[model samples]
Target: MGIQINGKGLLIVLSGPSGAGKGTVCSALRQQAPELVYSVSATTRPPREGEVEGISYFFKTRKEFRRMIDQGELLEWARYVDNYYGTPRRFVEERLNEGKDVLLEIEVQGAKQVKECFPEAVFIFLLPPSMDELHARIKGRGTESEQVMTDRMQAAREELNQIHSYDYVVVNDEVARACHHIRSILVAEHHRRDRIFKEQPDWLEGI
Candidate 1:
């Protein structure tokens, strides 16, 4: 049987620049730590190829998304290119209440907003080896127009300055190595004196 923890789950927020391999690193971390819950965001944009409705994102119409915002149902939200993207508050809260660590892979703007609401969350920033490599990776996607690519590069430069706000930084030079660092962070966080004591059994008291 697996060990049962009595404490509330951790809220882990990950953010990075456009070509920082945040998705790739999150995928590897999920495979390694299957017990961790991946937070599914809600978006007004239509699903792309192979994207599932609730699994990838809860597809909401613009009106519905705005309603959710008005009702305070989202943890954090942002608009990009006339599309809305936001983290739903209920699902993440339910999972955390059940003692399942929840991970949110979001953009830097949304991550900053989440920090205001959830100051206890583990904030991690993903980074590329270098700016040149980041540019190369963005161009390698081959789907964006020249203007779009230039805009993304400029955004990346600005996002890099936000690294100081995060609690940890993981460089995605190698997928396995990056995942290992993240796992270490999780383990260390769990072993924190407060978290450990919060989960300690009543029977161990006065021992």
Candidate 2:
């Protein structure tokens, strides 16, 4: 029989440039691994149509969000488009303690902050096939002005330069392929030497 990893849960944080298909891959991954608990972020922005609180996001007011940050209640936070977005620390830690692997989808800036709090967490960078393809994908959305698209491309370029900081880089050429790679990473990490061999097994004591 194969030995199983112990009860400790993993922290999986996924980040990448805009239009790199992070959301699409994550959606497929959640479907593939429904046991992976999702870490809902807290945002000061008003909930959009059909978005539910707690599940979609823990909607908070700007004052309350800043208070959470000041009180050291958030794992990572960032101001984007004049709104504050942050990860709640207590919920994630509680889930982890309960042996639930938590998944976090964060922006590049906020992700950098998460690294400070969870250096051992699995940080995966999703890269697009090419800059041209990335730009084309962003444009295809048809939701942004030309200037906004240019700004997003520039930000994406800056984010790409920091891929070296991540533990693994998954090129999102195809959604299915990308999800496969990410799942493989999760499985492999669980069997890593440090994770699986934290203490000597009694079976090998006399060998």
Candidate 3:
């Protein structure tokens, strides 16, 4: 029998602009690959309608979030919309150690923080087909006011400019297709030379 290469789980950071359908793609990925754990961020923003405290996010007071920062518990953090949001270090570390791939769905700024802390992470930048389509999608969602929609579009443009920074760029024209592409990227990463060697040390030595 051939030597087995133990697979080390991947740390994947998925980021995109507001109207890029990143959340939709991520949801599809989770459904297809039930093993992927979505890292629920801790946020100071009040829970939205139908958002459970711990499930959607670990809702924390600004003071409590600051305490976590002081205790060095957060892996990466950023302030947005007058609130703080951060990924807890302990939670991600524990999952990685247990060999479960962890997915972080966050913004461009937050993804930068993750890159700094976890350089091994594979970053995927989700993009819309075009700016006009992005605007149409954002407006169609009907969840935000005109002013908020404008602001989101502006932010999306800024985020789009940084697409070259990422390891992989997936233009999310079709939800299912985009999800399939992302899943392929993740699966391919696990079979990389370094990962394969690390997971099966004896395989390299015997050859």
TM-scores for all candidates: the values are 0.87, 0.89, 0.87
Give per-residue CA lDDT, model 3, range 1-207, as digits (tens): 575443567889999998899888988988988999999899999989999976899999999999999998887899878999899988898888888899999888888878888889999999899899999999998898999998998898898888887999999999999998998998888878888777676775644
The C-alpha stretches of model 1 lying farther than 4 A from their native spots are: 1-6, 46-51, 144-146, 198-207
Alpha-carbon local distance difference test for all models = 0.90, 0.89, 0.88
- Candidate 2 RMSD to the real structure: 2.4
Model 3: CA > 4 A from native: 1-3, 45-53, 143-147, 199-202
- The clash count of every prediction, one per candidate, is 0, 0, 0
The RMSD of every model to the true structure, in order and in angstroms, is 2.9, 2.4, 2.4
Candidate topping TM-score: 2
> Cα miss at 115, model 1 (Å)?
0.5
lDDT, candidate 3, at 52: 97
Higher lDDT: candidate 2 or 3? 2
- Best to worst by lDDT, what's the order? 1, 2, 3
- Measured with C-alpha atoms, the lDDT of residue 204 in candidate 2 is 45
177-206 per-residue lDDT for model 2 (tens digits) = 999999899888887877765533552454
